[model samples]
Target: MARQKDAFYFDGFRRSADYACQAAKLLSEVMHDFNPDQLRERMDGMHALEKAADGVRHAMMDELVTAFITPFDREDIDELGRVLDDVTDSIEGVLNRMYYDNVTDM
Candidate 1:
């Protein structure tokens, strides 16, 4: 199951990092396998990771809005959350394009 929404800023980042790692690993496996038929399935899995990362980011923003005392500036927190999610989103993007563009091989 998906991880619980981050309760703290550090948790959000750690969750995002985990999602990014999962995406990277999934993408690596896809490339190593080099199967066109499986591209769609791979894309689906990548998207799930990206979506999970997004959830943590969104939760982080929600917390930031209500948090009065933070370790850093609001902008920094928001930026970090965005950057963290981007790692997974970026990996998903690669798979997305490959699937849509009908890429037959690596």
Candidate 2:
């Protein structure tokens, strides 16, 4: 049971981090393609990836709460989870701003 719980926590963290990295890569590609123009379409994909990351984060939290012992400090785990989520949220916000301002061009 303990090993399974540890695996779940680690897996969730890995998945979340992977999503963030992938989203950043996608956003970078969008920026490259759009150049100075706002990245509207690129944002759609970014948002999707962000949501995926959030899902993993929520799963981790849920598991954490149910487990009697965590491999790391609960606060640390929560903070790391939030930071990963923040990366996606921040990207989404940038996309939102570009879309609302009608500055998006490619």
Report model 1's TM-score to 2 decimal places: 0.90
lDDT of 2 at 90: 83
lDDT of 2 by residue, 2-89 (tens): 5766888778778887887887777667666764443555777788888888889989888878878888899998898888888878
* RMSD from true fold, candidate 2: 2.8
Query: Using TM-score as the measure, which candidate wins?
Result: 1
| Tens digit per residue, CA lDDT, model 1, 21-59 | 999999899988889988887887887888888888998
**Weakest lDDT window of 10 consecutive positions for candidate 2:** 32-41
Q: What is candidate 2's TM-score against the reference?
A: 0.83
lDDT of 2 at 38: 39
RMSD of each: 4.9, 2.8
Model 2 Cα displacement at 12 (Å)? 1.2
